[model samples]
Target: MRKYGIADTTFSRVDMGKIAYKIIRDEDDEAEIIRYTVPGIKDLPVAAKRLIDEGCDGVITLGWVGKTMLDKYSYLATSIGLIIVQILTSKHVIDVTIHEDEADSEEKLKEIAIDRTSKHARNLVKLVKEGKNALTKYAGKGLRQGFRDAGEID
Candidate 1:
């Protein structure tokens, strides 16, 4: 059986890791799912890297960024760290983040987190089961996870 990793942050208002774990478990019963929770978004990179080193086929990292400028910079740095981890391990680390400003209300934020985490979790299954090219057909199709697809440009 294949193994997948989920790295999530406690700073997130929503329980994205639980949402993702449920989706992955429900979608693919045969695969093993390992979860690692950190205190904040900046710590996700190392957590994901550790999971990958522990033999996960791929990793899903979930984080929540505030609306502050400092949060933006921190998110950027965290993104770069995740990229470096992927490059070093040659593994797929899917970053799923939600900015607090994206939603107008707390309920909406939860909805976005659930939608994004669920979609990315399924994508992780597809990627591991089929291969990297599994999602290529949707490429340039303007597909989105948390919101409605933008659709293809005419």
Candidate 2:
């Protein structure tokens, strides 16, 4: 395996190397970094909590939000679901990655999914900063469900 290094930092391919490096230099000493990797859409809340319990400062979730070839059953819900789960976990998360792909065409089908996912991701981050679980109400429902709750900004 190829080993990559920066200054005195060295990383092995099989490790969460870059993240570990960042965590070490993170300004927030109270922060914990959590990464979630899954094969399918399942038990998102449980996954989020496990990372939080493990002292995760944030979460980077990897999974197939939708398949590019499939236009019908595949949708952005898988990505949106995990984000909502993070809302209920705690307010300690510093960042979250839903691992989605950009749309390939300008057709309505692709536009809808891409737009919804982008909007939800942005809103979820905002709600998280506000310390609220407003997005959880639409968990498992996908981006088409329009799950967003932005409370008063103070």
Consecutive 10-residue window with the lowest summed lDDT within model 2: 2-11
lDDT of 1 by residue, 10-101 (tens): 99999999998999889889989999999999999999999998999999999999999999999999999999999999988999999999
Off by over 4 Å in 2: 1-36, 40-45, 55-57, 62-75, 90-154
Give lDDT for model 1. Answer: 0.94
lDDT of 2 by residue, 10-117 (tens): 111112223333533342333333335433444444565576566553443322243344521233453455556557764332222222343343353333433333
- In each prediction, how many residue pairs overlap at the backbone (N, C-alpha, C within less than 3 A)? 0, 3
Q: How much does candidate 1 score in TM-score?
A: 0.97
The TM-scores, one per candidate, come to 0.97, 0.34
Residue pairs whose backbone atoms clash in candidate 2: 32-56, 32-57, 33-57
Best candidate, lDDT: 1
